[model samples]
Target chain A: MAEKTLSEVNERIRDGSVRVVTAEEMPSIVDELGPAGAVREVDVVTTGTFGAMCSSGLFLNLGHSDPPIKIGRAWLNKVEAYGGVAAVDLFLGATQPSIDRGIEYGGAHVMEDLVSGKAIEVEAEGVGTDCYPQLGLETTLRLEDFNQATMVNPRNAYQRYNAATNSSQRTIHTYMGTLLPRMGNVHYSGAGVLNPISNDPSFQYIGMGVRIFLAGSQGYIIGSGTQHNPQAGFATLMVTGDLKQMDRRFLRAATFTRYGSSLYLGIGVPIPILNERLALSTAVRDRDIEVPVVDYGVPRRDRPSMAKVNYEQLKSGMVRIGRQEVATSSLSSLLMAREVAATLKGSIEKGEFVLTQPVAPLSLAGSARPMKQTKEFPYVEDVMSREVVSVTEDISVAEAAQAIIKSKFDHLPVVNSAGVLCGIITTWDISKAVADGTISQVSQIMTRNVFSTTPDQPIELAARTLDTHSISALPVVDQDGRVIGMLSSNHLSRLFAGRRPR
Target chain B: MKLLLRVAPGIVRKPLIASVILETGALVNIERASIDAVSGEIVLDVSQEKCRQVKDALERLGVDVILLEIPVIRDDSECVHCGACVAICPTGTFHFEDWRVVGEPGRCVQCGACVTACPHRALRLVLK
Candidate 1:
């Protein structure tokens, strides 16, 4: 049976008789020796992943100031930290961008700087109270200045994630990295066979209180992470560790162009080979795992999966998607993952780290649920102006100008004789026409390319349309292609204002 | 040596690269080119001795010649040979050899893709 327990493994580790191998080496060792023989020979198989995790942060307790201010608002290195917790405790989310540097510098950078032993600028404001009289604070402090700085990541080390590609005309900057236009490139995350959860798919060995290597520090899995969907193979883990013990090599800050900030962290989990099942599980290879190739161009809740590819194909640096060979990139660093795994293995073999069985197994029943829309008016039809004032294309510039002046609308939709939207003209266009007396007909000055929306579309889509085109309004049309209403930015602003409670 | 030539809209239609080769007897190996009727940019490889002659010849035709000399600088101390820059480099500048990243700095066209994609901040773009 070749069975062992956590305590047995720890005893072997302490006695300098433990055998530890990295996930990369375990599969080959399993091939040389079957699962039963492998279990007898191997004590632990270490797995690791280094990728951008946005849902990671630091919980810091800055000891009370001399005046004893309760920080209502706080900033670390110009990046905002959540001050909604206790009086002195603050949570700095990795993805929160700096007020001045935007995505270039953020909470992730602050965390890295802290790990690098650099000084951080702190600014806080507090509401004055009898016991805590200080109203504002401005000071500089290092990572050691805080009473406690703990790394409490919410969701990390996804079991498996989809590869991303773009089918649109332009490049999209996503958390997956820059997906080139027309499937020019593919970006996939996850450390494949080297991922901890991937090695233990059913959560048999990984659960609450499982010890792990988080950013080069000893960490523990607190519970199933947020959006942990084991059914879909996208399981996640929530972990916590001491920030001061973390190494900068395993912690970094990254910025996706057009997207926001994220923390690049390394996590390693050592699986004690307790039995044949655990031994066989650690032998999973890159070719054994498959993930969907999601199209980032399709902006929706459920994006379309263009194809399925194994990690081997992704690691080969190219994958075929609909007859096109796309160059593939990995958002997670495999080299770093290997380094982390090797480091963990060395730590275990050196008897510096020991294994512990989880007190409670993680729950794999719940599925990830999309946020339900609860707004009173979610569609463009609910907020659009019903009485739209439009002019036919044949109308003179003077007549269109008169209608716009009388209606006091900045934009006027120009329609064909059959009442189909043909063009649009703004007050600025009319003023340009008036300045240059050559324009007589509305068609001469009216912009032929008009951006419009549909009545059945969601208000967010309409808002996106207006925002993407840099326009203040969109003519909402029906299924028959007739302008039924106008959705102006003013209407959207008013809708938001009306929805807000006074 | 690698060079990035920005041909003006007015001179994009001219056979500039052909002219430079014909005039100086230098070989121009174009690495990448995106040319249209309006304007064009070309990345080409040439010998070190011939690079100065080519640049002078192109500059005489009002073409903007930028000598791409070590455009992307790799900090060996920070780089872990992650290969994160390998798949995104349009010119295949960084590649894996024995499971470690190797950089061919001459092939890079200064796109800055690898610079941004690098997780360790090990690569930087120093345009000279």
Candidate 2:
């Protein structure tokens, strides 16, 4: 049981005599040399994960304007940034969408633009004070214009995350990405074997003030991330780094379709091989780690888990859910994760970065709890019939009529060539077509201006829309205008009666 | 070169793809076909040099032809080659080559699946 401390590893790194390997490479090395041999040979194992972390943001100290008043509100490139901290300081949240452009552009984009050396539009309003009388200021500011730009992410790396799938009849857009219907695809985040927190699951070396890599910049672990549920194996990290020193290649602003905006940044951490136990932990492989496959179609906080799958199956590009084989995609970039780990390893080998002992160990006691709700008002998704049957616009009127009859539904939503919502055909429309002796295509008689509702909309709103339009049902659509389900008045009445429709 | 051919209801039953291969001597790889009584849409791949000939041939058969030109555009500045597109593409149009995502535009059928799957918002599908 060979043992070494962080100071010993730092000493080796300083002398350019440290042996470093990536988390991906550590598994093979441990198998060849065994845990004891690996402890003797390897000084550090670098781990990395590059993924969408919506809870990440930046703390910027905008240099004081002339006669600056106490800032009450701030907007960076039309995306709102919180200015409650101080007179010249603001916190730019990555998930904040633009007030005008919405999710198409956001705080994440502003942060990326600033880091890319693009001038950002900064607008602030302040109430006039006795000492500082400036009311409002609108100016363009670059990353260099700020006195200090630091990334203080409340949640960064997750030890492991469940893969997402959709069991509902229609595709659902979520933070996990677009989940195809009936388990058509599995979307998973986290770098698995290359994950920093996963490699150091017990948080032995990772704690407060641990030196690490953050988006190609040197950073430190501040504390445990919010919702740090260690017992469920969902450990997270809160980190801080010099945002001005980060590389644009490792930092990106992203929009997840109907979900909202998120930030994708690279993070890597070095684990010192203190002993055989530490070496064994670093050598954990993708096959050894198992995560649940959660069905996001439920649209609930505690979505049902369909199955338990490992990273190996997920990375292999497909996973089995019941009797069907579903394709899998990773929202986290393993390629970029690999690059982060390699870069960190090179930095340590070149004596540019050194390991540091944690100032305080992360607490392992706290768990996440759901927010309490006063009333349970159902959304369109809760009452809508997910098993929707649709027909293509090119289908003949006779075929559309047959499909509507067979499905026992009066309305049949017509989709275009790309499966986007185009029109809706009703039994009455089909009957009129037959009586006219022009029973050609569904496009002839189908309602082109059909009203629709989203899954997240309140059931009351959906009911109002239906009543306003004088329609029996409203097709539930995604952001891309694709039909996912049907929300009929009958379903709402059933819900009101305390009975859920199948 | 990939193409999306929209055949009118009058010519929907005809073997226009066979005629294109026979007349222009171009190799046509039919990737996907959705046809009904009203209209038909076929996605096919052909050589770059023979693309013009194939389009002209299909047009002569009363088929509306569109030469698919990068249906899914990956913004190099925004894309980090994360492999989300590679895994979600049903046709396997995108693959990892040397740690970077390489797209085979000829294989893309304009499903727009990758556009939604891309977390970076780097990929966009443009269908004119």
Candidate 3:
């Protein structure tokens, strides 16, 4: 048997004699024909993955407006895009939240909408300059209106990732998706054997300038992705392409409630059957790929690990964690992955697509490390919820209840005429009073033994206090015992969730 | 022949399937059924000779009958076994066994909820 080359594969592809199959089909084919036979018969195998890619965004060069302002701020459907570049050029980060709506809408949705040909409201403010007189502009723009619309993602195609599960009593939302509490379900990302990087684990052929199928268009690997960890059993790549050539069908936006917005990217990579080694690599099975199962309940980057499980075990629907069988799910769409691979295969078979040798191969060494702490402690004021809505003790029970209902707050710090902390009233206290039929006065039902947190104190101390008491919220106060802000579990959860890498 | 039927609220209260079987004398192999107070749908396999009679009987009973080709699984090899389909599936078509996600197309009602709920977009409903 002779070794194959990319040029020969391209020649075969052009002549309609190429034997192409998807990554999903390679395993069985290799099993029947053996590695050498399979390599001899097949010319290429296409691999793909469609999942939540947060390190994705668009760089748009908007044509300059008449009397243009040197735009310093820009927004798309209320989601802010960085306008620090030129007056007409801006970069939109996929996870950048909406200023007004927060996580509900963001840059990802704006890009998806643009790809779908929906007009988006573009707002900008600029400092007036002689070259550009206009200081502010608000207008709708579509993908066709841009001078250049390009997707220049810094990192994508994670080689392998940890499967997430929650051990705490409360459900936690992360980029992994909603993790059900107490290990109710495990959520894993990546299409395993169907993933492109998983097939090219060593970055042998996949590197800078390698042709790829990006968002329904032909794109290229631009460089090594951020935090590229080749030795960590997975490969990552930075890819870019002309966004104008792509369609909405291949690009989508999705929101995971509290987890924020992410781009659903359709990517496919075609591997040239260069050798027997490449053929065997492409035939890697799901059972052979292993990823760690991490406990999402832990609030640290180096969170506690439960166990390492292979994709076969993870896909089995249930894995034994200790003595219990825990259910698992995947975030990456296997259906879309298959479709992408099949679509690429069709293109290759028709001689419309050809394999490319990378101009520059990817670096094999480098590892990502967590940010080191510079300060000993973080202040409570930094994390505390400053917008405190309090109630006066003189108010009636009905008034307090109405305040709680209208504000949608679980607890209200009660203040006296002197603006001093008098007591605290919670929905639980109100409910108990109502249940006991003593709902006449607010002071009678409010708990007087209120514990307060100081803004100057360490956040860890405040968190510890909240955990020790098992309280939902703590009123942050000054030395005078006047309520200044509120600290709650929701705030802590957001802080920790934000810390997790996308 | 296999058929998928959508029974309206008006016909849901009646013994429709039993009546159809009695009238046509055709064996009804119900693949799946999701019946609520408002509406109901069922997938069943019957003899080709009795398919036309079953459709006529169902229409007479005010049930919308659709001659359904089996729902095609576009890609089974890529399934990650996340069980998102198991939550919303009215039919016991999707299940988790041995820690992996499995789909029994024989029991599928072509509801399309699993296709929507699957985060990975791994399941697609192609009704021929």
RMSD of each: 4.9, 7.7, 11.5
Off by over 4 Å in 2: A376-502, B4-42, B46-53, B59-72, B97-99, B124-128
Tens-place lDDT per residue, model 3, A273-334, is: 78878888899999999998899977656778898899888777678788778877777666
In candidate 3, residue A288 scores what lDDT? 90
Worst 10 residues of 1 chain A by lDDT: A493-502
Residues A1-502, candidate 2: write the lDDT tens digits. 7888888999999999999999999999999999999999999999998888899999999888898767889999999999899788999999999999899899898988988999998899997888768999999889999999999999889889999999977777788887778788898888889998888788888899999899989999999999998888899999999989998888899988887898998999999999988899999999988999999977657889999999999988779988888888777788899999999999999999988889888887657889888898888888888888899988899898789977646899988877688889888899899999966988788898888889998898788778866899888999999899998889988888999766
Report the Cα interface RMSD of each model, rounded to 1 decimal: 2.4, 1.9, 5.4
What is candidate 2's CA lDDT for residue A80? Answer: 93
TM-score of every model versus the real structure? 0.84, 0.80, 0.67
List runs of model 1 lying over 4 Å from the truth.
A380-456, A471-502, B4-22, B25-50, B59-66, B76-84, B116-122
Clashes of each: 0, 0, 10
Judged by whole-model lDDT over C-alpha atoms, candidate 2 comes out at: 0.87
* Candidate 1: Cα lDDT at A434: 89
Between candidates 2 and 3, name the one with more favorable DockQ: 2
Q: Which ten residues in a row have the lowest lDDT in candidate 2 chain A?
A: A400-409
